[model samples]
Target: MADIRRRKFVAVLGGMTVAWPLVTRAQQPVKKIGFLSVSSPGAHAPFVAAFNEGLKEVGFLEGQNLAVEYAWAEGNFDRLATLAAGLIHNRVDVIAAMSGDVSIRAAIKASSTIPVVFISGSDPVQTGLVASLARPAMSPASA
Candidate 1:
């Protein structure tokens, strides 16, 4: 009887240990990301699909563990600032500014705290995005 009780207790403890991490992970809040682009929806479709695929590869799925808010300037340079501000107002955890330096500049100007990632063809340092290539002086690391 003692051996059977010990075995059961050990099994229960092991099961709980195995399940604890999963429980904690499930309880975690969903991450929110802001995708800011200067191009129209039709032009940005492929990039958006690729971004979603990358996120899925890392175990993040839209409407599940992650939520993405897309803000497009629709090729209007004047609207970039407003769109970036809207993303900040939505309380996005991170901003992905795509297309060019204008989108990145808008996102940076919108918020000083929120991290901004940019995809620019020009040199980031020369574009005033970061202080240096090694240690970026901005919100967070840009890639």
Candidate 2:
């Protein structure tokens, strides 16, 4: 009877040891990212798909461990700032500014602290997005 009880206890302890990490991971909060764009959803469908694929490559999946909040200006340049502000209000971990420098600027303006990742055709240095490409002043290392 003593041996049987010891065996059962050992088995339960082993099971819990194997499952503990998974349980803790599940209890951890999901990461949230804001997708801010100056174009319509339909127009930027391919870009969004690519972005999601990139996220998957980096071990992040939408609605799984990560949540994406999308804000589109629908070609209205004047609405970029408002949309960016809305994303900031949503409390995203980071803002992905898509479409152009305008969207990037809007996201940067929305929150000074929140990190903004941008896709721009123009020179970011000339646009004042970064001090230099080799040493981006926005990063802590440069600061």
Best by lDDT: 1
How would you encode candidate 2's per-residue C-alpha lDDT over 39-71 as one tens digit per residue?
A: 999999999999999999998988879999999
The predictions' CA RMSDs to the true structure, in order, are 4.5, 3.6
Backbone N/Cα/C clashes per model = 0, 0
- Evaluate all candidate structures by whole-model CA lDDT and list the values in order: 0.88, 0.86
Candidate 2: misplaced stretches above 4 Å?
Answer: 138-143
lDDT of 1 by residue, 13-91 (tens): 9999999999998887999999999898899899999999999999999997999999988889999899999999999
Model 2 local distance difference test score: 0.86
* Top candidate by TM-score: 2
Which 10-residue span in candidate 2 carries the lowest summed lDDT?
Answer: 134-143
| Residue 74 in candidate 2, Cα distance off native in Å | 1.5
Candidate 2 has which clashing residue pairs, if any?
none
